[model samples]
Target chain A: MNWFLKGTLTATLLTMGGVGAMAAPGVTEDKIVLGAVDPLTGPPSLLGKAHSLALKVWQEDVNARGGINGRKVEIVFEDDGYVPARSLQSLKKMVEVDDIFALIGTSGSSQLAAMMPLIDELGIPALNNMAVNSHHFNPPLETLFVVGPTYCQELAAGMTYLVEELGLKDEKYAIAFQDDEFGDDVRCGYLAGVEKYGLDNVLELEFKRGQKDFSAEMLKARAAGVTVLVSGGVVAEHSTLLKEAAKNRMDITFLGAHSAHLTPVQALAGSAGDGYYAADYVPALTSLQVPGVARFMDLANKYLSESEMDSLNRYALSGYAGAMIFEHVMTECGEDLTRACVIEKMEGLDGFETDGLLGPVTYGEGVRHAPTGIMVLQSNAEDKTFSIVSERMEVE
Target chain B: MDYFILLTVSGIAIGVIYGLIGMGYALIFKATSVVNFAHGEIMMLISYMAFSIASSWTLPFWGLLLVCVFISAIVGLVIERVFIRPMLGQDVFSTVMVTIGLAVMIRAVVVLIWGADPLLLPTDIGDSGVEFGMVFLYTSQLYAIGLLAFCVLGMWVFLRFSRMGVAMRATAARETTALLMGINVTHVYAIAWAIAAVIAGISGVLLGTIYGLGPDLWTQGLRAFPAVILGGLDSVFGAAISGILIGVLENLSEGYIGQGLKEISGFLVILVVLMIRPYGLFGTPEIERV
Candidate 1:
């Protein structure tokens, strides 16, 4: 018994020694390589360029600080043009050919859906660039990491604010959503909100992707006496609908998902978008205290063109947050980091705060989703700026 | 009562613009058995051109509108000379397929140059709400509807009496026979495209006033397709009338249904009409030789 106990102790020490042994270059010894794919020249290219810029800013800042514990971090990006097939091809090349340590940011829900299986099979950690579907955080896989608020949560928050906070409970509400899974997720949340409030006042409408004319949809809303409009669509459709509605003089209140409240929509809608309300996950750029934003403003002024400086959209913040998390995880992993160690360290993170742009980021055994919820913004049409209507709320 | 009138009048106004644009489709199809899928893009481009000429050159609306129409006609001639001209002797199916490709290319070029952001065309015609007793009308709506009527009448006169228009009709009826009779069939083809482009330019200016100018405006071409198809692919007058009909029907359906059937009601109408008429309301009856 004494001999066996001695032998067991000796074996344990050898195993520990083996793990500590550094024969080859450690992951954080000289450089850490990461890959990202974005749509640089597609319909969503505006969002893509913003995300890539955010990634660059984060990487530059990290390198300036001596990078993840005295090592440089390198980011390689490929333009996917928002095509799912191309996104999958680029992701495969990033993993198999380039052999990136991990994928930091990817764009689009459909593009992510196409690459999800391969992402799981490769066991590579991916911080989603734009996939905000709730299922991304649910049944959390070891290889997947989501950094944004889910559409379900965002929509629910919008609904709650309209019903509980704004006293729009008795108002006749109508929903116009894109006819797809992303749209379905929003409709599900909307319906769930109506049931929870028991308002007995709801209208639902769906438009196919790329549909322009919404006269029929607007007419139906007018007929139903819909006073509150909830839209889950992109900018082009949103702007078109708003203009059409104004032409008919509906005078309805609008509540839009994040995708609908872009700069293009704001510009097109102009004065008609005065009272428009939208829920966002990231803090506004106009806020004073966000740590990195001020720095970003300085860098943007110094580096980015004047035209690009003012046009920065939501993707810019999300992209920067993604890079911030990547830096945090890599730094925490230390010099002798492996894929497993990186995952372990990232999973253990709690109260992960950024320059106050995002709420506290938390990921662990039971909790995988990180976002705190909606930051309600109302358009000040006269000023052409969004004003914070409600403090950031954690709806979920 | 207020909402109903508002919805009805606005619907009719938009439908008028659609009808005017739909007339281009009918005109091109009437002259050549080809459906111009790029019609909306052409209209969108002309509107952009008009905006550029007016804003950049500081020309008045009347001058800009006339120049825009002339430039659109030239563009139509060039498109015929380059893309459609080469496919004259090819199968009609292949020729029709080229327009689809042309539509995509136009949209890409537009986005590349202007980006995907929407641009509003500022028109001072009707800036305020004009109350007509109990109903209210925007000056812009009045302009759109009035312009639509004028374009419709112009198309009627051109097709009904002009010598060149008569030659176009002869070529449309029988390209082979017209060619044999030394009717300058090529000129007729070019003329048809030019006329179609003018209609598209007028519609574009009208629509830009109502919906703003954007790259995605090509979808309007698809939306207006059902109107032309239902009206009669070969009848210019029918296409114009059906455009207004479809627009009004869509709004009325939405106002009454409250479930969003207005969006697809035009397509539904096309489906039902196709099943019943097969050749459309004014389309030439197919005489199949078994």
Candidate 2:
């Protein structure tokens, strides 16, 4: 027999033998360690750093509250640098070396996708709050639970709001998106909305990722007389699109994915930044209206420095909310806190609350993607804030 | 037709910025025969510097530009002295590799200071634009075009007329012969780096105003490469004009052809140009007698 086959059989035997005798890998009598992988260094660190900080805030807050079921909570964070291969490596290291009980911060969609196989093989109960796609939940992994809606869901809901609430069903609706998976998701939502509303879809344009110039796209949109635009840009692209629209003096209503609900986008767009809508699953950091957010802000102020406070955003809120759900599930799993028990509990979650930080998280039989409320927020450039303009625009 | 005009005008406006950056690459390669892989990162660093300067001092546009020019000159001199000078006698590929290393270090340092978030350069210059009939150009965009013209004219006069510029051209033509002819070869290389850095610095601030400064801004350095190769790897004049050409081609392709074509249009032109004239349009061909 080959050495590989021999090692595989031995490893299988060792795993089967250990599974019956050992408690969950990361659980101890005094502490429960969770693992996270995020882009802590590169350009995507804008999202990753803020996100990890939010998770830090949750760690502090939870530990201060005596942790989950009298055991202190410890989180092990690994920097993936936003690379998919690095993400897989980080997850493996966390599972093997760190011996983490669960993963709470699964980074970007593609990065998470890269790490999904190891997660499945190891049966790691991962709570993903960062990036959600239909692929993450459909034929859902038994142990992976996702909070918040996909970009498609959020965009579709935004379309519903624009069509049903604002009565813009007659306007020339269009989507200018990056030519990638994320952009494809946004287009899916836009097309879904177009089909649902029976609206005139005048244009659907795709531009390359990292594309700064939108003059051509805007000209095309303008020539087509597009009035309503669904922007699939993340940050700078959104601002550039708005600026281009403003430069042409085109009175187009702009809607974007949650990535647009950022101060930089507005700041970059300058005077042209105002009056765009972003569909988000979580409240903005500036949103004090939500009870959970107000409390999180209070904790953030107490725990984080002013510079750290600057990193607070919807990404942070979602991260904190995901931590809250994880805490709830683990606490309910009792003192033993086995991986199976935690997975079972997560699968049975119903109406788990994070104090309006999210709509409500509920996972069911053969369904791991939780239903959450979506909000359409309008950007007020002067204030660098988003005001919620809709109610329960949740797409289950 | 209006759409075509709009795309073309915007294309030229953006093309000038690309040319400005491409000039930095061509200038370095022209003097040293070493391609600066770090050109983009250097632009990003200078842009962040401009952002910091504009934020703290509240300098007017021209005031900020002047400060950037000074800082970039110093930065270029420092980089050339510290990094490039040591590898002077080494293989050109080694020097290029050092630049790639410098690029990585500069990128890391920028992230360390700026913390990875996209920052808008704190200036009111980006606030407005001027429109003539069917097309509009941001004030910064206009500055970019004017600056490129100034650079082209200045480079033309300097290389043709000025003693220092003539020395640089001589050094570029034949380093050993220029050294034999009593040219300060090291000084020429240093001057080239400083001049290129100043160009990059100005381009950064202009682009920062146009697109906002981000970690990803270094990408403009790479995006401008097609302009450089299409112009000629070693031709500053070619780099400038091809930048305009490539920018128009990309815009027109996207405006007329489709979405994905714009991204590839410059590369397509470069492939064709390289196939036909490897030295590029208006690039002086180099021949070696075996």
Candidate 3:
């Protein structure tokens, strides 16, 4: 085993030396491959698997319509299992082994941060995905594009509505965030929004991912008499928070991050989600009024089970929308199918709309951020469904 | 102050689950002297089975729990026969490795079957908060605590009075002497695993209700390890008590110190406990031949 490992390592190094002079290790004619490394088998696998499946569906749909202008778009997906080291390894394999046109729909900030140097060196036209970190926006790369609103924009929209529109400018609020990059971005957004609006009455608490109990955190919020609670964590943590608050009979309203808008929340939180709210970039799955979303629901029914269809989760819709964006970008590139042409067309697209999955994605000078619209969803216990209580509002 | 109580209750609820599983670990170690590293995986697998039987087949919770326990017991027997039985005379390291491998295999099989997506397992115990003076408690939390208490009493009584339990104790006391006295050590080992599996099933189901079913459930095995060690690997009651202690301690640390200290604090307590009492708080001090 030792001898074999050594020989393989030597071969890999020799191959790298030979291939390093090329544009990338694995670009080929008649096919443009992309890599998607995300957690598909670990704790956060829910998000990764959903994103992958959405990408799959989109790619199939595009292929059926003549394959990205006659050049097939294939994605060589790698499961990073939500770790930085694993993500780096997968990114290397994707760039070296199954080289493709560009990468899209990656998950997690830390995972993306690990691949930043490679992305910069390769000058790859990478999408920021649904990661929502501020680093993706700061000192922006010429080849990178953010197809969704940044965490700051999303949080600003939520807080702006609460402060200016809802007449809750002076309302007592508490922020509970995960202790990670994503959480920091959320806090930054909230802080910026509060200052911009000159709003007062806010407190902050933080929790780590995979930490189940949140009683002490909730107690501090309770002591402060917080009316609104914002959390930057996943479904499990939110559910535990809701259950604990319900136990304490606290009248505080819960606000979840975009990622926590999931199917499991309803069951996990149970009655604790009676009046919970979340800020969403896309229309709620419960909204059948939108044409594109109606079509999406119909397609989901045909392809997936009702149980499998977490129609309310903005992530799934975002996943589906991401696939659509790739298709549109490929079409704009025409028959040339080169990475440069695709990037040129993508950066040139102004006010590109997606029938309400998002408002418009326009990449231009001093305007790399896209889709600043957010809607607030309130959980209704009587029907066991979340209803959009506020209309879509634009950020700035 | 109010928040502290809330955190303590929530922590205790989760601690009860750890205590129950830790009890299973301690019980198995006492009788067979083999650490069942796969206990959490077994529990998760049995919970999935219960979901299939209860929700899919429409069995009631009570009926599902009973059927799940029976199936888990059989699975425990099969594991011992196939894995542990082969390493009867082997060193302790070999047995431990086999169980670790078995843990990996169980998690892999589960992922393959379940497709690595988180599954929702809604408990039928009514989702209303019970008011207790100033504090509120989820029905599931109360249900979990009640179940833990029942299991602790049941285990205590069984070990004190039951013939099979007494035989298991005898085997643990002196394997060669018990064999010479006509006690079937093999049966004792199988029973130990069986009992452990039942307790694990309860923990799995409760945890599923609290936190949805996912492939990451195996991490609980690692988290439960500290509790088992702290309570003494061979002391069943000690394991249960320490599980709660660790759980409460973790929450308190996170609550007071802040900055995501629950995970670190739990391990810190384990380290401190080990340094002070090498054999664990309640672990039987072994008298080595050397």
Candidate 4:
């Protein structure tokens, strides 16, 4: 048994060495390997799985189109489970072991922050569509290009639409946010909305993550006579807050960050989720009116399994768009494909379109983030879907 | 005044759930002198089990409760026999550590079986609530409070009259003395685990109904820890009352003080209560022979 094990290890090492000798890092003559780190196993898997599925669909489609410069694209996904330390470790393994040329599907803001130094150290060109934090772009790295607006930008734009377009500036506004960096971003937008519109700031409440009950918070909101509520929660918390409000019979206009644009939110929130506004960077998943969404759905149905097709949401659209952008950079690099060449193309990218999936993306010169605009969506409880209620509005 | 009443009522409803879970901890600690750290995981597993069952068939609330209780009791007995029975004569700390390990294993297994999605437990009562003037109560909240009362009454009767219950009490008092008195200490331990598991199962189902079930549901067990400490780790009745007290205190603190005071209010009460009465409100003072 010991001899057999030793022989297997020796053979594996020989194979790895042979592969290393035959190719440049993450790029063989016929294959260009890419890597992704996402929260694939824990609570955040809802987003991560869709992210991976989208990448898979893109990979299949790109390969079917005769690959990028005759090199079949291969993507390796690592599950970070939404932990920052794990995200760092996953990126290190992807760089040193898998020798991935570029990275897509970065984890949450903090997780990506943990992996930022490693990404810079390795000089790996990466695209981030999931988490768009201000810190990532404030002092930009050489190779990381971010798409999508930050939560602050999304919320601020949504609030702007509510106050300016909907004419609810005089209403008593309040914010219920989680006590974390994500919550802080939401608060930044809420403050911006309040300052811009001169709305009555009635109440501001911060809750711990994973807090199941919001009875007291709802009571306080009621006590303050809050007419407009900014829900600063994601996923289950979004549904939970709405549920509590429904129970209290509080009749208030509700708005949520982009994360609340999920079908699960509407399903979980049931009747209460109806008519709630959600701010997002991308077009609605069920928005067949959008040409990009129609194309994505057609490709997704052809490539993804039935369950995978059903699981397709806004994250899938973002992930597909991110992958599409990366594909374009790889295509532009052509036969002289290298990390430096890819980065060069990415930095010069401007007016990049996703065929209406998102607003035109542009990153050039010192700019690291693009598509800093948001569209407001309203939930339709009957169909468990969101409809675009506002055109793309940029946030300063 | 309406806000206060609403907050207090809701707090009491949640406090009843805390008490229900705390009783499971106290029951095991009383019998075996070891904390069942996996009590919350047991609650979580049973709740998930209930979720699965409810998904397959539409059982009335009472039928669902009975099914969960039966399945949970069996799981409890099996766990005790497999994990706790072998460590019976060893240091009590070892048994406690075993429970902690069991907790981690249960959490992993649960996540494996049921993916980490927050699922709503479908029931006949769907977001229906009754309003008495300004005070409104969701049916699930009212059910939780009523069920806690029923369980407490049932526990009192069982402890006061049943032969097995008396045997459990005897075993808890002194293991060797109870052995000499012809009480099967091992049987008592198994019974205690089964009863505790039933309590946890019921509490978990009610909680899942109210707040939706997710992987984080197990954390509520840890949240109930303060209630057991304040009520007296060995006092079943005390745990129930303290659970309500903690719940009310937490809500009142959050309602009045605002911010995120609700999460810490229970611990603050536990700290003060422990400082004043080291043995807890109903726990017997231990007179150790030096």
Candidate with maximal lDDT:
2
lDDT of 1 at A197: 88
Ranking by DockQ: 2, 4, 3, 1
lDDT of 1 by residue, A25-141 (tens): 124458888888888774677788788877877787778778887878788898888898999889877765666788887778878777777777667778884667766767777
lDDT of 1 by residue, B1-290 (tens): 76667567767876877788888898888888898988988887888777667667756556667888899999999999999999988988998899989988888887777665666665554235576764555566676678778877877787679988778888888888988988998899899899899989888876766667777777787788888999889888878788888888877777676455767889999999999998788788878799
Position B240, candidate 2: lDDT: 95
lDDT tens digits, residue span A1-396, model 3: 235534764576577675444333234445667777767876677778777766666666666667765767788789998898888788777765676568885667778878777776666767765676657656666666776666667777777767776677777877888877777777876887778877664578777766666776776667778877777776677777787677666887677767656766766677776878777787767778877677677676666656566522566677777667767886786655656766777778787777788777777764445654787777765566667777878766
Model 4: residues with Cα > 4 Å off, grouped in runs: A1-24
- For candidate 3, give the lDDT: 0.75
Name the lDDT value of residue A193 in candidate 3: 71
**How far is A267's C-alpha from truth in model 4 (Å)?**
2.3
- Regarding TM-score, does 2 or 3 come out ahead? 2
Tens-place lDDT per residue, model 3, B1-290, is 66678668767877888898899899989998888888888988887776666667765556667787889889888988998988898988899899889988998888767655556665566455577867667666787888889998999889989999899899999999999999988889988988898898888877776666777776776787788999999999888888888888877776677666777777787788889888899899878997
Clashing pairs in 4: none
Q: Which stretches of candidate 2 lie over 4 Å from their true place?
A: A1-21
Off-target runs (Cα >4 Å) in candidate 1 are A1-29, A248-251, B1-7, B48-63, B122-138, B258-260, B286-290
> Residue A323, candidate 1: how far off, in angstroms?
1.1
Worst 10 residues of 2 chain A by lDDT: A1-10
Q: Which candidate number would show the highest TM-score if scored against the true structure?
A: 2
RMSD of each: 6.2, 2.3, 4.6, 4.1
Each prediction's TM-score against the native?
0.90, 0.97, 0.88, 0.95
Worst 10 residues of 1 chain B by lDDT: B120-129
